[model samples]
Target: MATLVATPRSRALGFGLRHAREARGLGVRELARLAQVVAQDVSSWESGLRVPKLEQLGVLFGALRVAPPERARLVELARNAREPNWLERSMPGISPALSTYVEYERTATEMVNWEPLLVPGLLQAPGYAEAIMRAHRLPPRMVEREVAIRLRRREVLTRHDPLVLKLFLGEEALRRSIADPAAMAEQLRLLVRAAQPRTSSIRVVPANVGYHPGQAGHFVIFDFAHLPSVVHIEHLRGSAHLYDGDHVAAFRAAAETLSDLALSEQESLALIQGVITGLE
Candidate 1:
């Protein structure tokens, strides 16, 4: 049976397992019979609700005809499936952090984002995103690839049963100057459009709001309908996903703090519009 404590790493491993099975043209029952497990357990493993043991992973991967490289990567994920937090570094064969985050994002029923320095990734306009990526000095191809991926991520916001998002932006984020004024204005405009009644709540935290929990850093909280919540903390090198109760609670408290300090949705919209006026 599947449980709510499935970690993002487990989900990534499950994603890999499902991909490998589909690539080999094996259905759940077909693979389950080959691996000597019930079809429901295979479904549970593929959905990340339950993790198979190391021995079971061997049987499953062997049955799926997964390549050595991918099998090694997935096996590594299974090895750490119970870890409470995941630091996005030194992942073998594939970049599981991106996969893990994307899977969490897609499945999360509600998302609370706090960005002090820039627009949240999901809401970033293409030009604003490209400017930030180029500033990082990423190669042209990588920039294009990331930008395209970001655009795809936005799809989640508008899909059926769209994500219930609470976005808290720092006041300075609206005024910060980017390479292109038009793009910056457009970015703010995007914020205005997305901050409507049925879309999302976009609020701003004034810079002078002395010392708050969010001052420590930016983070995102993803809440799932039938599973445990996950918190994502992004830093200079990479990001970390937190799945344990204490860590997730700390971030949730931070979200509550930001909610108290941020401007009202309407006020935030007015201030954002004012910034757009300044840019023009």
Candidate 2:
């Protein structure tokens, strides 16, 4: 019942390129001639039916006389276009990482997030996000920029047919206040409130669980309408998007085990409230 969907970025990039061509007073036929690519190829790319390859991207960029940084961005986008996987499709531009995150949020039917170190991005309040970003010493403008992006991302929760977000947090994340006590309390209350059946659900893994697979780090598993479940593992340097049958099975098994070990929905809210009280 699951089918793999191409990353939204591919389509967006293709559309951008097409628009760029038209803005330059060049038709698809003209761009194809300039890029030395087939007219059908340009047509397919513009229609989002297919993405151009790396060499093809270079030719197109050259034809447009795109600047170096812009050309580099386009090349990066082309590299991302490879395999038409989430790694390629979910993000298409310079900020591909964040774009990918946003795209997944849009199309996902279900999302399971486990974060061991910090609060999950989807649920972070602006003040809490700002505090964390500041501690990391990001420039003020960058911190503000990321906070804005994160807040915008929250819109997914209110969409007509929103993605079901199931979050599992390590107890330490809740117990350790990232911001001031007042801010932390508000975030804790927010988490508890957000667990309502209609919108979102959250469960906390007690530290007493001793050891668990998620202890290694943070990851998100997404279920898409057209694809089998895929797990996104994030690291300090890079990320791996897992879709292989075996890897997907293992991640799913881990999620099930974690869900079993974590507190039930009602108990989780109680636990959150307890932490909020303890914070004061």
Candidate 3:
């Protein structure tokens, strides 16, 4: 049988559906029988060669006894297998690309981030985040909303089975003050506290590191267990999600280079501490 090329959304749905079914010890034939579909159809769905209709997805998940949150996520994925979920309709001014990026962040098991100008959103403290948003000239309401979103994003750091985050931050990110001296100091201290090696690692690339792939701009690599990895690049207008294997590999290599150029975790923490002390 010719294999169907799988896009990110279809791949996610297929993997989730297949995982749920296998966890219940059901083979493809068994699941097909239970869901009243042909064996080839079930195989196609599981392989991401075809996306199941919403009603069919309901039948499959029901047979597998998939539970609440996960079942809802699977349904969402099935409904939008060909395109990103339309979050902008619900979230008034939110960029469609950003909405999709948020979904990717939620589902990703691991994330590698390279930030050249400021702290990554997942690590920015509330005060600093607010300050940065305001500096971007966002409307007062939008600034507040964006800051709230940043804080909410940070929740992933503390969630049960939190994401494995590897962050490469430019040294100037530490010295750059987004808010008042006190707020910057607090933000630096928060960075020190959150730099736990098990769940999160923060590394700073010194200013003197003359040239690197990261000099191109900020990007994030989202890694999944079942679906293909993707790289997200953000710009002033919108963002780009790169799924092509070569592009993904190049970004992965860049991440490794940045990691190597960055200071050790302990050294990075000490440098942050020194910056905080200077602020005091």
lDDT at residue 118 of model 2 (Cα atoms):
68
Q: Residue by residue across 183-243, what tens digits does model 1's lDDT show?
A: 9999999999888566688999999999999989899999999878889888776788888
Ranking by TM-score: 1, 2, 3
- Candidate 1 positional error at 279, Å: 1.0
Over all chains combined, what TM-score does candidate 2 have?
Answer: 0.76
Q: What lDDT, from 0 to 1, does candidate 1 have?
A: 0.85
Output the TM-score of candidate 1: 0.91
State every prediction's TM-score relative to the real structure: 0.91, 0.76, 0.72
List residue ranges in candidate 1 displaced over 4 A. Answer: 1-4, 90-94
Question: Lowest summed lDDT over 10 consecutive residues: which window, candidate 3?
Answer: 83-92
Q: Which regions of candidate 2 fall more than 4 Å away from where they truly are?
A: 1-49, 54-67, 76-94
Per-residue lDDT value at 46 in model 3: 68
lDDT tens digits, residues 1-280, model 2?
Answer: 2212244445446656775687688988889899887799898776445777777787787787767865676566555654434443323222555555566686678998987756787888888899988997888888988888887887788788888988888888988868999889878887876785765878888889988888877889888775456578766544566666777788777888889889988888898898889877
How would you encode candidate 3's per-residue C-alpha lDDT over 80-110 as one tens digit per residue?
A: 6665212222224654355466667777899
lDDT of 3 at 132: 86
